[model samples]
Target: MQDPIDAVLIGAGQRGANDYGPYALRYPDRLRFVAVAEPIQERRTRFAHLHKIPLEEQYESWEDLLSTPQKARGALICTQDQMHVGPSVTALQRGYDVLLEKPIATTPEDCVQVIDTAAETGRQLHIGHVLRFTRHFQKLHQVLRSGILGEVINVDHRENVSFWHMVHSYVRGAWANQADSSPMILAKCCHDFDLLLWILDRKCKHLSSIGQLVHFRPENAPSGAPARCLDGCPISDTCPYFAPFVYLDLLPLWRDVADTSTGLVKFAAKTQLRAPGLVRAVSKVVPFLRQMSDYRGWPRSVLALEPTSDAILEALQNGPYGRCVYFCGNDVVDHQVVLMQFEGGMSVSLTMHGHSHLEGRSTRIEGTRASLNAFVGFRGSWIELNEHRSDRSFRYDTTGEVRGAHGGGDVELMTAFVKSLQDGSSQHSLTIARQALQSHLLAFAAEEARLGKRVVDMEEYSERYLS
Candidate 1:
């Protein structure tokens, strides 16, 4: 057996510990977690212990880890949206390849900086665009590239961001606000942007978009309802967006651990020390304590917290997750549309809406010789091809192939990265940083067009910012 490649983890949060890190655990002969840096002591300790990392190899922050001599082949930068650039640049400079989580960075300039740094440092930089590795999309790409759907002309894509997910991540969680995290386009739909570019294999020429926070507002709150779901709100049972019902039922074992509070007053008042107001008065007697003592999977280990009904209830009562979705501080659009004109006259229309009952993306591609349609959701993906003047059409069901996380793309991506590191193959093309830049640029421009309410010339945007 070959010796495992040494790797370092910069963030022990969700993506780091649950997503990419587990691959090493599963295939111990291929990769090893030699070091970890996390601000949270429990998270850092748990991750280090799982990987059997030495005490000297553990640190509190990325900066502390970077200050030491480079000890691993690559670093997994799993920090939040805004925290990507600094650590990535430092890692590249320190002779460590980086497997960075998506969005590249929160801002366009920073995204460009990371790409440029990777190129300048002559190091491997793979962005976590896991969708490209999925069998469904890989099949789509193969079909498109095979010339079966000759002369690709236009594309229609829809990202149906399911209702509950919108509330959990965007409306009620850390990504609720744009300024604090990232624009909805960049944070949520950048993957879609990357898919569009990859499928079409064309440079974006022009872009326009429009979207807004039409729902999930205080004005839209159901009448006679309290701020928190457990606060004797009359409509709690009926309201789909109710905090306690959604968190307890949907999240199941997952809880917003950050919302732990011993007194109901803590959940009611903006300040922890303040007394509860009338709307939040019911929480005075209820102690919203965290009860998630297990960290098994996904949101469990991802959030580095346990998932229990009490934890969910506690988070809903005292934390951001508990706040009424309609009354939270979320500004990201619940629905959006982006129009892209690619080189060679091909066009793409992408619709991202958070009000859907179903989750996943659906796409239709129109070409000269044939038209292809696909629906990718929780159940899996299916692609149908209809040729011109064809007596029959064909359908390809990819459910069997979509086996693991993110439709099996996560495992594929991790496997590829581990192999690339082991073989020292810098030429591998799966999600190189420069290619990810184009997708990030398109998403940023789409946001600009959406907010500025005008068409954006990609040439001009690239020259002004990306250059």
Candidate 2:
């Protein structure tokens, strides 16, 4: 067996610690993390403890970590959206191959700079468009290549951002404002753009987009609702987005039960309705209740480093995670859609909205001989095909046990990166910087089209920004 590749991590946030860090733990023979740089003391310390890195190897900033000579064969850049370009360019220049988290940078110029740096330095650069490594998407690509769907004509894709997830990540969380992060389409749906470009195997020729912050504004807040849900909001009993209901999972059991009703069942429902505080207290006494309440994993883990019951409650009471979704000053769109014209006369439409009940992605691809419909969700994933002139139909259950986030793509992407590093080859990489730039460009162009209210020609957009 090949020796494990040594890598350094530049950020220890959610994706860094939960998604990619666990990969090394699971497959120690393939990869080993030698060092980490995280600004947050708690996160940096926790990540070091988990990975067993020595005190000398952990740094408080990416600049401090990368300022020295290259410490490892590769660097995993999982910094925030705006912090990506600097670490990536510096890492490549310092003789380290890079696996950068997606939406490469907030701007086209910065993205192109990373690509140019990698090329100029003669080092490998892999963008974290993990959807390409997923089993469901890989199977979908196979079915398309088999001509089972014949010549594809058009495609419709939907990124269903579950309501809780929208409020947690985009509404009140890190990506709520475009000025702080990239646009919603780029930050959230760049994976979708990369998927479309990869599966369709064509460059988008022209595109236009339309969307806005239609909901989740102060005007949409219920009458008498306060800025914070914990501030004795009037609609707590009925609001699905009440902070406790979302974070503590304390919504009423019977959705139709009236809060004023008098009965054993109704009483139990009402008790459950007000159990967030009780649950938080009891979780401290009974340790297992923490897992039952989902305080150890994502949506909750993103809120705190420790993610203890008390920690979560404290975050809710004062942190961004606890803000009322409607009252939070989130400027990213609650919903958006993009339309693209690809080569070979194929058209595609991507709709991304934050009002879904479940988090998942669904797509419908129409071809000459058959139509294919597919869905990949947190609960399960499936793909179905139907013939045009006949009654023949086929179904595939693609829901293999998901190891980590992104439909098991995270693990698979890490595996690919490990293999590439082991062999000193880019052939194992799914998408390099230059190819991944296409999807980023598509996102930038779509944002321009949405804001400018005009169709953007790919050639013109590329020359104006990329050239």
Candidate 3:
């Protein structure tokens, strides 16, 4: 067995604590989190407790962590989009490799700066484009590269962000506005662009795009609706995106029961659902009980500052999460389409929609000899292949319990990062800063094209902005 690599976390928020930090717990032999820097006291304490880090190593901010000597072999930076460059550059210069979360940074100039800093400091900088590590996409990559799909000509990809998720994250949640975070494309669909570039292995030559925040605005707010869900304006029952209902009712089901393993649902039923209040509540409402089956962790986290209806209502009425979806200050688009012409006469089109029945990506690739249709999702996913001349068809089922967050990509990425650090090799590393910069540039170009209502020549855009 290999020795565990010591790591430090920069932000102990949702991604740092819940996503990557759990990996250290799950595989203690592979990675260990020795220190963490977060501004929030409770979150810092919780992360330290989870990782068993000593008190002296916990700091209130990334600056404090940097002020001290470097303590870990690597840094996992899960800070906000705009916050990536500073801590990442500092960590690299101070002699630690970094695993930065996606979008690298919010702007094209900042993205370029981070990449340059990594190069100048001579440190490994890996971006969190985890989709590259998924088994489903890995299979797709293998099949596409096998020459079975000869002379790949065109690709069509769609990312359906789901209506509920769109409202939750973009309309009322953390990533609600462009000026505050980033354009919807870079913030949400950078992974899609990265994946397309990876599979196609061709540089995009031209870009065009169109999108707008057409749905969530003051004009679209339901008449008589309150600014906050719990304020008693009216129409709570009819509004699917109502904050209280989604958090109190649907989020629990989505978190605990939806698309999870049967064993986990069984375990939740035995341990979580058996709480006296939950049982008593479910017993009286049989159909609702059957539908939800008692999973309360996420809803409780978002709604209840404490575990009670009063607390939940208090938080909802007071915080940004409870704002009316259409009345909030969100300006990010609900839908977007990017058209691309890559080198070698291949064309690609991507559609990113926030209003859909489900959350996942669907892709179609066409080649001279064969074509493929694939669905990558939580419930069920498959890839269909057809050969033009042979009249033969093949189907591959690529769905199962994804071992970690982002369809098992998180664990796989951590494993690869540790191995690369240990072995001094870059073979398994995906989306290092330089490679990620290209996709970020493409996103910037697409946005410019959309805003300017003109086709963007990649060479000129790259020269003017990214260069």
Candidate 4:
């Protein structure tokens, strides 16, 4: 068997945990997650203990890891939407190849810095646009490239990011603070941006977009919204965010180490429901439930939170829209339409909506020669799709296990990154900084076009801003 590669993971947040936690536990032979760097001691310590990593290897911050170097062969930057650039740029310059999570960076300028550094350092910087590595999309990419689609000309893409997932990411999660993390455009749609570029095999020449914070904010916060999700909140029944089921139900899995003598693993195996360890850890982030499991203390918790003020804020927490904060917090639009002109006049129209019922992705394409229709269900996602000609329509679908977002793209991404690093192959790393930056720019251009209510030229953008 080939020796495992030693790796250091940066950031121990939800995204990082999702990616590194599994690989480190199961694939110790193929890839060893040796160390991690995170400022939050709570998250970092929990991550270290969960993985049983050595004490010396765990650091309170990335600078500590950088200062106290060991045998790390690669690094994964899984920080929030805003954190992708700085650490990654540093890691690349220091000779460590990077697996940077998507959006490249929150903005175009940050993307440029990371990309420019990679060229100078000669280290690979792999962006985590995992969809490209996914089996479903890979098949679709093959079909499109195989001339089966017959000259792809036009495209449409939609995402049904779930209400809960939306809240976690956009409402209370790391993505809530757009100014700190990113604009709504880069926070959610960079994957789509990169994916479209990857599928269409073309560059964007123009883009126009519009969106609004239609829901989820202070005005929408239930009359009894507590400061946090856990514990007593008068609005327990009234507010969608008050439920502890999603956070508490998975308690064991989130934290609380298994009691081996009790056959906890075996018991959990039978039910396969709770992961004690994980529950314990995640619960800490919102420990109000433990403090006040009953709703008696709810009023106090409610007192802690300030009233929802913004139109977007009102829409996210408690509004006419149930838990769907499509209209919530700040000014990010719940629905957005980006009309783009790709290189060679191949147009791409992507409508990113806060569509609650559907998740995953849906795509449509039409050329002078042929057409295609695709569906990637959010929950029972098997990636169903069909193709069309002047006369015929072909359909396909896969009924698979209940998987997370991006259509199982996370695993596909990690495996490809591991292989590329393991073999010293250059076939990957094709998601160059310039290419990634273009996606960021397109979002910026779309916003500009929307704000100005006019078509924006890519040439003018590149020359004026990027130049």
What overall lDDT goes with each candidate model?
0.78, 0.84, 0.80, 0.63
| Lowest summed lDDT window (length 10), candidate 2 | 252-261
Runs of candidate 3 with Cα error greater than 4 angstroms are 251-312, 426-431, 465-467
Question: What does candidate 2 score on TM?
Answer: 0.90
How many residue pairs clash in each candidate at the backbone level?
A: 3, 0, 0, 44
Candidate 2 error regions (>4 Å): 250-295, 427-431
Candidate 2 vs candidate 4: which has greater TM-score? Answer: 2
Q: Is candidate 2 or candidate 3 better by lDDT?
A: 2
Model 1 misplacement above 4 A: 251-296, 299-304, 400-402, 429-431
From the highest TM-score down, the ranking of the candidates is 2, 3, 1, 4
Which of the numbered candidates is closest to the native, going by highest lDDT?
2
Compared with the true structure, what per-residue lDDT tens digits does model 2 show for residues 89-175?
A: 999999998999998999999988988888788788889988888889998988888988889999999998878778888888899
- Best by TM-score, which number? 2
Q: What is the Cα-based lDDT of residue 49 in candidate 4?
A: 82
Q: The CA-based lDDT of model 4 is what? A: 0.63
lDDT of 4 at 306: 25
Pairs with backbone N, CA or C atoms under 3 Å apart (clashes), candidate 2: none
In TM-score terms, candidate 3 sits at 0.90
